[model samples]
Target: MPYLAHIGPIAAIVAGVLILVMPRLLNYIVALYLILDGATRLLR
Candidate 1:
């Protein structure tokens, strides 16, 4: 499979695991994701 095809699911699983392990990190993770996502969209 192409790497891009796997990225979404893998990212979700990793994020879920991180949240489960460190609930406190949820805010940071979400904020970072939003920033990165917005940056990518703007760049594109």
Candidate 2:
């Protein structure tokens, strides 16, 4: 998970793994990813 060095990246990786375990969580994960990414971009 070297690519997932940051909190956001780590969350993304965890989300991906969670999705594999429970496909229903994909929507939530993607939504969260987008929200976090958007927040980071906007704040930065």
Question: Which candidate number has the best lDDT?
Answer: 2
Prediction-by-prediction clash tally: 0, 0
CA lDDT of every candidate: 0.70, 0.78
What tens-digit string does per-residue lDDT give for candidate 2 at 1-44?
44333767777788889999999888888999898877765665
Local distance difference test, candidate 1: 0.70
How much is 43 displaced in model 2, in angstroms?
A: 1.6
Q: Could you estimate the TM-score for every candidate?
A: 0.62, 0.68
Name the regions of candidate 2 deviating beyond 4 angstroms: 1-5
**lDDT of each residue in 1-44, candidate 1, tens digit only:** 35545555666677778999999999987777666556555555
